[model samples]
Target: MTCFLIPTVFQAGSLSLIMGCTPNASHSPVFLLRGFSGASVSSSLLFLLFLAVYLMTVVGNMTLVLLISRDPRLHTPMYYLLRGLSVIDMGLSTVILPQLLAHLVSNSPAISASRCLAQFFFFYAFGVTDTLVVSVMAVDRYVAICDPLHYHSVMSRQVCARLLAMSWSVSVVHTMLHVGLLLPLNWAGDAEGNVNLPHFFCDHRPLLRASCSDIHSNELAIFMEGGFLMLGPCTLIVLSYVRIGATIARLPSAAGRRRAVSTCGSHLTMVGFFYGTIIWVYFQPPSQNSQDQDMVAAVMYTAITPLANPLVYSLRNKDVKRALRRLIGCGAVDS
Candidate 1:
């Protein structure tokens, strides 16, 4: 959101000096409150924090991918869904982190028009894919619970692959629609001045606000696409989980039922955190105090969620840890 015009200060021997190109020409520049007041802190501190988060997120997701790939025993519907989630986590982190880190340190952070559009495309696409993955996971659990007899056949590898493919394909279509719509819009500045946006990245809402023309079509498209991607899947997940809970409760042995529910507790917790934060941020009406609040929630889904994923899935999963140990050539059995 912070529109800083970066100037090619000077290029020396394999080094360059860059300066924040303030408005020197006739046009007056608009200053947007890009993000939280990290302007108060030293740039080094911000960079370090972002770096640490990025490293942890990447490592966690990579570990999950590695574990799934190495251990053939983990070739199941659940782990497949988990690996898909890992892919999205890695992709989403890559989309946001590097630019954010650069912006944190650089006095004048500037991204090219093409890069900005590309960022939005990937970010939204991955977000939609992640939502679908969570829904698939919910259905996986439902199959394991409500239809145990045909769980394997019902949620076979082929079906899972097709579902994963659908998620990615739908997300691509969704992102293309928005990006194509943006291409025709006159994002260029007028004779008066450059635009002011109040977010860190080129988020759709802020970018649309900066546009000179009406964005009703864009807004409607966003609402329709977002609603279809989120609400439909979310409803399915909730319903599947509800039936799963009922099926668990009807079990004869209390301990068995408890253990069965425990298998999904972590995933259910994750889903709750994901959908709760997202709904609170997007579905509700905006308020004057919503900017900072929304940023914190955004950090949950963007930064913290991916970082916490491996922890959540691993800590609560005996099978994953067992598989990891085996993959590492540690003892196959845990004491």
Candidate 2:
């Protein structure tokens, strides 16, 4: 076994260097990302396709936000939470997609260590925001459906504001904790001071894998702390749905029960797909995980889910459809 360890330690803002096992790893300031196997051959096609996706994600989410904001009928707690979700979706896509587009067209996939960690920070931050906002939406839905008489009082403006504030602040601090843990570890790179990150984006797991220092504690933190953060919201979502199901079950009208089931089914399907991909990406054993597999799963949440959210939560909504139709009618009458 070959080992290299040195006691020399250096610290800079959000970075620390401590030489450890692996060739010249501590000296590296940049990491080469392995974007895709065929990037060179079909980069243009992939870029065009993804650019279209990014554009649609932006336009769709923005339209939903505007629609909800403008329509007085859509000013309830659910729509408010949905608007928050759209804004966060746009943010999540913006943080990941544009950087990814630049890397796709560039000759070298080199990303500076600082830039790489920055991506890591924003990606997880927005992801946690997504989770929290969805959980808040679930709470809104629970109150509206399960206890409609007092829904307004229960989920008032002040309460909603606080929930949203907690969601954003907690998400930022959660991501900061993860990034701070990673800051002290030195990266492993080759003769050219380049660590080859397997995934396109700077996800935390890949960055941790590229580290030269021992990551036992980091892994422990991820599994224990990260798991709690993710799992807690997921449990909230599930319980909300379970209560919704029970409430619907008591509906004396057969048709009413079916209609409720249809609506909730669609919602659960979309949420399930969104969160299932997250679980697949994050909770797997290291030995069983591969970069390619992670990349595929990543596309579902990072790309597909954001794009689909407007359709799932907004376009299908009868209130939104009525609002859109009314706007179109107004435009037609004006012309």
> Which candidate's lDDT is highest?
2
Off by over 4 Å in 1: 1-33, 36-40, 188-194, 279-288, 329-335
Tell me the tens digit of each residue's lDDT in model 1 across 1-335: 00000000110111111122233321223433367444576778878987999999898889888888767778888898899899899888889888888777676666656777888899888877888888889999898878879999999999999999998998899789988877655443435445545667666655655554445566666556655655678779879988998899889998989888876887888887676665555444444354554465556677877777788888878888787777677733222
TM-score to true structure, per model: 0.84, 0.86
C-alpha lDDT values of all predictions = 0.70, 0.73
Pick the TM-score winner: 2
- Per-residue CA lDDT of model 2 for 26-73, tens digit only, reads 633688777574545588888888899999999989888977888888
**What's every prediction's RMSD, in angstroms?**
9.6, 7.2
Give the per-residue Cα lDDT of candidate 2 at 125: 79
Residue ranges of candidate 2 with Cα displaced over 4 Å: 1-23, 38-41, 258-266, 278-289, 332-335
Query: Model 2 — TM-score against the truth?
Result: 0.86
- Candidate 2 achieves a global lDDT of 0.73
